[model samples]
Target: MGMIDQLLVIWGEPAAGNRQVIGHLARSAGEFRFWYEDDLAKAQARGFQMLPEFPVHRRADDPYIGRYLFALFAERIPAPTRRDSAEMMTAWGVDHPDDQFKVLARSGGIRATDRLELAEYRAVDDDLSRPLEFRIAGRRHITDAAPLAVEDAVSLRREPDNTADPAAVIVDRMGRKAGYVPRQYTQLLGGLVERGVPLQGKVVRELLLPDDVGKLVVRIVSSRL
Candidate 1:
């Protein structure tokens, strides 16, 4: 299993610049789950563990917009050859081949055109007062996916649910009205599913957020390492 180190969410509109931050993740047995609801009893009952919630900054005077969430998985990569370093101080063979081994690591942010292996959907519940459950499934092997504009992702409002007679899913990307899907990413997700890739969660647009925040929803189905 791969390790999920950090999850970052960037929110806000392009005109407003983006309000962004890196999120701290709570540890699960081998995977991590993030939800927008206030509670997590059912997920716990399903054998999924909760990592800690990322703290939110609340302002008394301002109304709250939604947040963008990013998940980072840290898979161990083999150390590069010591000679690969542009700077070399000590030579190999003396105490430990170059007294110290130092290398810079970079975070993998989604590019405009990167392939994401994922399944996305809006969270649904039996009652209005009940919590919404968003289901995400990651792909085993995904590539050439790109982040879609706010208007491009698709909306999944209602679907048959075995748990409830009239359960429904509603997602509002940009928080316009109740919820609607952006068209572009939705098509991409559908293609992956048709190809038989394993998915993690449904990738939906974050609504009520500023339209300027450029971010992509990606799923990790196969091991990249």
Candidate 2:
């Protein structure tokens, strides 16, 4: 509801199968803390591996803490010294491109070389008056789709049967399946839906990239807010 303080380190791609929540990276008491989720063993069985920089022995009870962002995530953000860094900063709505946490949250920390991605984690009890923006996930799997334009209205449908994520919220454009909402927001938005809160979504922007890997950003608003 205020400033985002945590992000879910997601592993794997939903389209490929067995997408899992690896862990959580949070800002606590003026320092950064990171820990693997309790069910890491289950994820490991499904092809998930502990990051080389973060060994599995480090449990949730005793997490890794540091004054700055962990190298595992810090490397994902583009360097502020890059020639196009300013352009990238503007694209991600980051006022200070060097602020690694903000950059990571806004950019999704996605890379083609790996299946790992970061998703802003929001508490279900947090205020919803402020509109939340997230990039539609699984867009690479959407086929035979018309291009989405900015300001286009979208629809959200709960997918209780979804194996990857039971709380998954499917984003639809004109009755066609576009993609699912990022995993991080599912619990919060899903909880709102369960309480019969009216939620609306609209396309705020779209980025058409190479290899048909287009991304769409949708802004969600709740009537209760």
Candidate 3:
């Protein structure tokens, strides 16, 4: 199976509910590499701490290289031995559950145990003509908005004045504020919007259970066709 080359490591403060890119992980020719970003210091000041496997004292310029995936991320992948492992992998669009890089990219390496997550870093020129899925962020804060249902059409609006992130792209449902696009796709989607590229969004999934309320996944496609 094919694999992604790079992923952005994002750290979020659970209390404040803010996220920032703190590092990058990459794979090239069988070797894996990881390095902290300059933003690491800012994240540290915001109550983020060095991961046990990645020391804060390490110089950002010197990347850690290894033949195997870092434990920090490897642990996020569901164990192949789990009874529902195949279902989980299929949900993430991964055919091979053992393809760690692809799984991480599709799943965002999200785990309840940590605030760290991974996002595939797509190039500015990457094609968006194909449909892609992105979980709407900040839904929990949109209490006044009406519930969204599958197949519901959504609109994207740029929020250049947003205090937290100038590149923010908000999703709207039935003319009400639903949520914002995940930060990982903001740069890409925001750039496209700036270029006057028409984009379309439709609700692909919605979790309505008490615990997973407001969790939504939207399918986005460039309307350049």
Candidate 4:
């Protein structure tokens, strides 16, 4: 039976423009990372404020935000140790990473249309530093969540009928591109299931795409519902 699937992106700012919103999703595609600061900065400079979406933790003390950021970056790359995240944080100048962020900012990656000011970074080390491990916020367990619904999957694959913008269409077709917030995907999957959708065995995956678009895929695995 062709299930009535509905896919929804589980991360990022909803008002995140064409590239940020997650609707009925498809496969839980894996994860990927690319330079996004430019797009984000331009949007912020242009006055595009990140729209407080449904599930993004609102509290300033929310560890999920950090966890999610790390998870999004760490997944598939390799498991980073505590020392790794901390060391990378230290080398990147958690307090002044904007130096690097500016590189993305000038590249027109951050949406100049939005007024989203992201934290910038500076390199403290002389050699190219790479993130060796990844840790999710909230210590989110990756094995606990169900996959996207069958209906959501189908919708994400097909083009949206309402929007005429090709970029929007491309982003939507890309599935959920925003970096996932570690254990946050479970919350996202649960949120959709709670909405009366039948998503019992879905997992979030990643999709391959071009340079400008953030790529992510949501797959419906049969085992870990």
Per-residue lDDT tens digits for candidate 4, residues 2-35, read 2111221222333433233221111112321222
What is the C-alpha local distance difference test score of each model? 0.27, 0.77, 0.78, 0.26
Each candidate structure's TM-score, on Cα atoms with residue i matched to residue i, is: 0.19, 0.84, 0.85, 0.20
Candidate 3 local lDDT, 133-163, one digit each (tens): 7778887776786678878999788889988
Model 2 over residues 90-166: C-alpha lDDT tens digits?
Answer: 87767776667778877778776677877777777755677788888786665765457788998777889987568
Better of 1 and 2 by TM-score: 2
Better of 3 and 4 by lDDT: 3
How far out, in Å, is residue 169 in model 3? 0.9
Give the distance in Å from residue 54's predicted Cα in candidate 1 to where it truly belongs: 10
Off by over 4 Å in 1: 1-37, 50-72, 76-165, 168-225
Task: Output the lDDT of residue 181, model 4.
Answer: 25
Any idea what lDDT model 2 has?
0.77
* Residue 141 C-alpha lDDT in model 1: 17
Q: How do the residues 134-165 of candidate 1 rate in per-residue lDDT, one tens digit apiece?
A: 22111111132333342343333332342431
Clashes per candidate (backbone, < 3 Å): 45, 0, 0, 60
